[model samples]
Target: MNRRNLLLCATALAGSFAAAPLALAQDAPIRLVVPYAPGGPIDATARALAERVRESLGVVVIDNKPGAGGNIGADVVAKAAPDGLTIGISATATHAVNPWLYSRMPYDAAKDFVGITQMVRVPNVVVVNAARAEQLNIHSLADLIAYAKANPAKLNYGSGGNGSAGHLAGEMFKQRAGIYALHIPYRGASPAQLALLAGEVDFNIDNLAAAAPNIRAGKLKALAVTSLEPSPMLPGVPALSSLYKGFSVDTWWGLVAPHGTPKAVVAKLNKAFTDALKTPETKTRFAALLAEPVPTTPEQFDAFMASERAKYQQVVRASGAKVD
Candidate 1:
């Protein structure tokens, strides 16, 4: 062959080798792991985002890995290949609080994953069964605190599970109010809410989105929101911070990839998520759940995670909430 032809042939082969991996990577399906069971707020949020994400990236799958207080699903994603294709949707309880709450975690919250972006934040609402609230005359947080002080260990509160956001919020309330109420931990929020409705428990600190409808229907009476500011969904309800300074416990959800993922891939995923949050449909959906869509850069998200971890660590220590 002529020298010129040989050079062109060699150049073409090199280009193909370089482009092959990029093509394959683009075609691969991205797996988004939800570390909780289906039908919950996190799962619903994941599914909503996934639909929009698919528009940006062709194929995406949401795999539910529920167990062990979300450790099982989180660990699976944490240990997966850091090729950007495998990501996990995690909550404040899993990423921020788990390290301090669990005796021995299978994975390190900071070291095991890279934060892509924060999705949303939902306030935790303090609610009680309407009938029970009327009987106890616990129309507000002040009423509950007064009652608890008067009758120690008589008021029983339920939570999603041990070491969950609801449980921690209740503990924080106890600490701030200086009351002694019995804690009843259930498998998840649904069961705990059920327990409260069945008159098995006095009250619960649950996600505002989950409790808002019940509150509006008069099934549950919202006493207060665990946020510094009042929730739009419950405008009449007061914030816990109003009664006790700095009292707040809002649950947040975010997306993270396995540690060591390429920076370019993380940036791409962040862009997709940020773009998804910008869509009117997504914003409306998140709003419906009393969740605010918060699109942030990866570096910003990392810093936020660090701060949240520190905050929750203190709460865990204060509450002495731990799981073996």
Candidate 2:
């Protein structure tokens, strides 16, 4: 063969080799592991993002591994290869509070995953059954507090369970507000909210999305929000933080990959997801679900999760909430 032809062939072979990895990455579908059951807000949001990011990341798939308070699904991502093919949803329960609440964890919440970006925040509303509130003559949070103080150990709140976010928020509220209200644990958030609706429990810090209908129907009177600011979904309702400075506890979930994933891959994932989050379509859809989209850089997400872990560590311990 001529020297020039030989050089051309060699260069082509090298180019193909260089292109192999990129081709494989582009073709391989990213499996988004949602640490919750299908059909909930988390799963719904994951599906929405999956649809939007498909153009950028190729075909992204949703894998629900819900169990063990999200530890089971999170562990799947924790143990996956760090080649950026497997991404998981990290939430307040999975990443922040569960580490302290559970005696045994499948993986380190802070170390097993690298944040890509924070996706959304779902505020919890402090609500009372309207009939029960009227019966008790409690019209506002202050009125409830006064009632609690006047009738110590009489006021009780319901939660999904002992270690659930609702439980922790209630505990933190009790501690921060300096009130003593018994906590009534139920099977799930639905049941807990039902207890409140039926007047079995005096009040509940319920997920806004779940409580919105009741609140709108005047069955549940929203006293305040657990978010730092009043949620747009609940107009006129004050934020608990406004009353108790810096008090904030709400459901938040973000995208994350295996801990050792390359920085370049992480940045790429962050950009794709954050871009999708900024779209008007995503914002409107998330608003319908009563979730506020919060897009942040990977470093910012890491910092946010770290702060959440620290804060929940204190809150979890204070509540004496634990799981085996």
Candidate 3:
């Protein structure tokens, strides 16, 4: 072959070799880890996004690693090779609250991960057992606040755990309203909710999705929603912000990869997941779960997480909650 032709041939061959690994990477299954157990809103949302991104990103498998307030699973992601194959869930706890709440952290919340896209946000509702509310003459947020003020520590609230979102929200509520309520921490949100249903606790600032059924069934009286504005899911329920100047606490989670993942890979994953999050299917499914899809760029998600961490640092310190 001529020298020019030989040179072109060699270049083309090298180009094909370079493209082979990229193609193989696309075909490989991604391990999308959930930092919680299998059967919760976080898991469910992760699964939904996985299915939606399949056509673009290939098979995405879920790995549930639940323990130590999500640090165990998150640390798996943090310690995983940053090849984009081992992305995991990042929630308020994993990325924001856990750093301050835990005495020892498995991973640095801000340093160990790269944000892909924020998935969804589920507002919390302050709910009382229907019978308990009736017996206590608590019909609204004002009434509930008054009762708590008049009878200090007479009312009690149940949360998933000491440092879970529910517990932090309850603590913030108490601080804002200038009232005290005994906190009862259960194993998980389900158990805490069960405690509320059985009247074992007077009230709970619970996930709207989990509490919606009982609220509709007239078993739980939703006094207020923990959002800046009233949630459409709970139309009649006023926002706690209306009563307290700054009472907004809710559940949110998203996708993340180990820090040091290439910017190109992070962008690719972000585009795939954010596109899926914007779809009508995702919206409908999230609405059924009482969540709102929040698709944001990596920079935006990072900023959001930073603000959250700063906000929760104070909350956690004020609550004096810590895990050994």
Best by TM-score: 2
TM-score, one value per model: 0.90, 0.93, 0.92
Task: Pick the lDDT winner.
Answer: 2
**lDDT tens digits, residue span 1-324, model 1:** 999999999999998765543343357888899999898878998899989988677687899999888899999989998777789987797889989988899999989989999999899999999999899888888998999989887988999887888898988899889898888999888899999889999999999888878888899999999988988778789999999998879989899989987777787889888999989999899887778998999888888888889999988898887788
Whole-structure CA lDDT of model 2: 0.92
The digit string of per-residue lDDT tens for model 2 on 149-187 reads 899999899999998989999999998888999998999
| Candidate 1 vs 3: which has more lDDT | 3
Q: What is the alpha-carbon lDDT of model 3 when measured against the actual structure?
A: 0.91
Local distance difference test values of all predictions, in order: 0.87, 0.92, 0.91
In order of lDDT, best first, we have 2, 3, 1
Per-residue CA lDDT of model 3 for 207-305, tens digit only, reads: 999999999999999999998889988888999999887777978998899988877778888999999999999999989889999999998999999
Report how far residue 229 has shifted in candidate 1, in Å: 1.2
CA deviation > 4 Å runs, candidate 1? 1-25
Candidate RMSDs in Å, in order, are 3.0, 2.9, 2.6
